[model samples]
Target: MNLFNLIKKDQEYWLVDQLKVSHIPNIEYLVAFDKLLTEWKEQRVAYLSLLMDEENEDWLLKRRFKKVSSIVEYTKVLDGSYIASNTFQVEALSDSRVTDSDFATLYDLCRSGSANKNKLFSIRQIMESLERELGANWRDQCFIFSQDSMNYGISIPHIEQDTTDEGRMFYFGVVPEQRCKGYGTKFHAISLELLKTLGAKLYVGSTDTSNKHMRRIFEANGCRLRDIKGIYRIDIEKEFIQ
Candidate 1:
């Protein structure tokens, strides 16, 4: 009875699968979640997070889950028509031989455009978690793009395991020094093409409402806005009282 995907980093975090309990009657999801919480208490899960659709929003709210932010979802069809750029070269992490210091620099680039004011995980935590989620070949899917030996940004493009043709840019960012220079658009386009090569026929992307840069990138890439979801969280260390 897997209710959510449990990811352990600096702390344990649960990504709730709303569809798993959608068939349950009103408040039944809450009952099921409560049982998992008790069983997982010794694991010290910091929090449980859920992207709320209308189906589970009402019941989730009843449990005093805090609405942290709203996420805008976008979708695009991959047509294998993307052309490679001659000006910039994209190198997969596995082939790039990025040193620890280089990785730290890349992590800094990701941190620069992060939407969360108080980041939940550290660099090591993030790296480990990504490896756990994406598996050993994660490096093959992570890439760095550069021009004239100067790096511009990074992108993690991969197909979602549950959906064969559905793809996602799990993470995408432009270095702080290169931001506002229109590199985000190019980087994202490259990622889309990369996903296509990975057998992705469609791409799904999301960004927080406050992330104007990312929102603009999605629009610039011509991705259609599909839906918006509320990001809700429950602190496991605290009592659940509404």
Candidate 2:
């Protein structure tokens, strides 16, 4: 078994990547990995990525590193409507699912300058987020659909706390030309219904505070803002250098 570590540091930050471990069989390896991670933390490393074999037992320990004091606040939306009479036509993703060819149309309408402005949530970022946040459990939970031949989708991530009755809904772009119609509502309602059925008492989502159109949509659909979290990033190496 080969274990590979890639460590890169610059004036602004340090990145550590550990990949290609065949099998991690014991606490010794776990302690060693922890020690290495601690050393990085001591060095003020800002970001770390671990790529481990899914079959390895040591992977269980990876959850420990999530204890960084930093927090990424998502703008949470809560769903309060009673689910008695609303008929939401929700469709789950399947092997034979057919998507509209013009997903870009929806993307342009819903995303466009927003994606370009934030320098975040790029196509690649969205794909990576899906993999990390939803891919593991999506087989049983995700929903996808198109608004009038334009594809749009949402992925929900389960929250750890049940009392909040919350889940996260991530909206991928909608078909562009189909905007101003009720397609966005239809897509969102369907997702909400599915969440309700899955025992989600409240659903939350986030967007830039400046995004009035999206905020309005959420308001129109009976979603209320629960909290606002500020986003921040620190370059450990930069701080160290300073």
Report clashes for each candidate as comma-separated counts.
0, 6
Give the Cα lDDT of each candidate.
Answer: 0.75, 0.47
Candidate with the greatest TM-score versus the true structure: 1
Worst 10-residue lDDT window for candidate 1 reads 1-10
Q: What is the lDDT of residue 123 in candidate 2?
A: 57
Relative to the unseen true structure, what is the C-alpha lDDT of residue 3 in candidate 2, on a scale of 0 to 100? 36
Worst 10 residues of 2 by lDDT: 65-74
Deviation in Å, model 1, residue 43 alpha carbon: 6.2
For residue 136, give model 2's deviation from the true position in Å.
Answer: 2.6
Model 1 over residues 161-213: C-alpha lDDT tens digits?
66689898767888888888988888898889889988999999988878888
> What TM-score, computed on C-alpha atoms, does each candidate reach?
0.82, 0.53
